[model samples]
Target: MSDISSFGATAKGLAKNPIGIIALFIVLIYGFAALTLGFNPKLEFWERVPLVWFLVLFPVAVLALFGWLVSQHHEKLYAPSDFRTDDIFLKKSQISEKREADFQASNEELDRKILEIVNRLSKEQLEPEKIAKQVAKEVKDATTFIVDGRAFLGRPDAVFTYPIAAFETLGALTDEVYFKLSKSVRPFQYGTTWVLRNESTGDVIRTLRMLTATPPGQPLTDIRTLREVGIHPGNTLVVEPPPC
Candidate 1:
């Protein structure tokens, strides 16, 4: 296994160097040509034997000569002191450190945004309607701005329903009317509002009320609340919200 691995690595190294690859190709072609000429039926038995021996030994001799030449100039071809294995490891370490730093910076920014939102909501004089709008806008901006999960990156417009009961409820609320969710459907949190639209006519259907916890299995699918809305599995909830 080790021998095979070593040979593979050697072959890969040789392939990277065009000169080495060309030399190998030449050797193979010449060896095949030599074998063909050596076996010519017109030659006598004794002559054919010597010819075949020459054909076999000539390539071996050439390969030995190449090895000798390479050995003589091995230091010039690859200066051992110039390249260090430790240098490669050090570079890898630096790259890893940079990635970690970038991740921490992103986390800090998200925390700062959350803190700002909390402080705003805590203000005693803010109206309920204004607070609701602010929360919805924040949720929309956060969902669109920071992409994290598989669904966010790939299908940012669609909301997944099965795992979160809130998403299931949202789907129920928007049924029959054409409505869009944010690029991603986050867990229902205070102050967020999801806008729904009419699918066929591209019109505003209705805006979902401020985000609130609803008991699981509660029927949010009120026909009076939604007009001609249909929610089904595997449907892509539009990402772009309807114009105000």
Candidate 2:
């Protein structure tokens, strides 16, 4: 049904245009002139040719030239439209813009919360007790749990897990103890604990252990019965008397 409508529309458009009518007339006239020239020797022979030959040939040549000219004009008018409706270019641009806006909005909100946390921590002395209080205040609606690795100084055997997104923002929690406690520098690993230094003392005595799982099913506190608990810190032991 749609194809029939499209065909009717095309026919109507062609019927309304003078160029199509004129082209048809020129073709008919050119055909007649060709037939007349074939039989009429007086029109064809240069020496005895009649004025009608020039008259018919001139008009046919002019109309033929106009047909080509009209086609070129039509082509130029419609050519630029080919790229305007491209789905990959225009649609992809819209998708990219939407994603960029969403990302920026999310980053702005996250940054605001991070600034508040950093500002509160900056005002207080860097201590385990105060940091915990600040964390509780800042991260609203998040499940908060504490892992106490009391023996980080001796064996570096504490394990923790935390959300990677939150960790990415906070960067590495560094303190004086981490720099001064041991000459060794252990890189943070996934599903493993790394010592968090007391920012004030640079001591690895008590490190903040994170539960690194995304669904965060890993135990934040050491579960002696569960072997698949949170990852253990490299070269460190979780002290019995947890700091938290």
Which candidate has the top score in lDDT?
Answer: 1
lDDT of 1 by residue, 109-218 (tens): 55677678868786756877877787666644443321112232365444433311123133344432222333344433212333433333444333333223454333
Q: Any residue pairs clashing in model 1, and if so which?
A: 175-229, 176-228, 176-229, 176-230, 177-229, 178-197, 178-199, 179-197
Model 2, which residues run further than 4 Å from truth? 1-85, 128-244
lDDT for each residue of candidate 2 in 107-157, tens digit (9 for 90 to 100)? 565567667777778787678677777666555422222333435445554
Give me the displacement of residue 194 in model 2, in angstroms.
37
Look at candidate 1 and tell me the lDDT of residue 176: 22
Candidate topping TM-score: 1
- Global lDDT of each model? 0.46, 0.43
RMSD of each: 24.3, 24.3
TM-score versus the correct structure, for each prediction: 0.21, 0.20
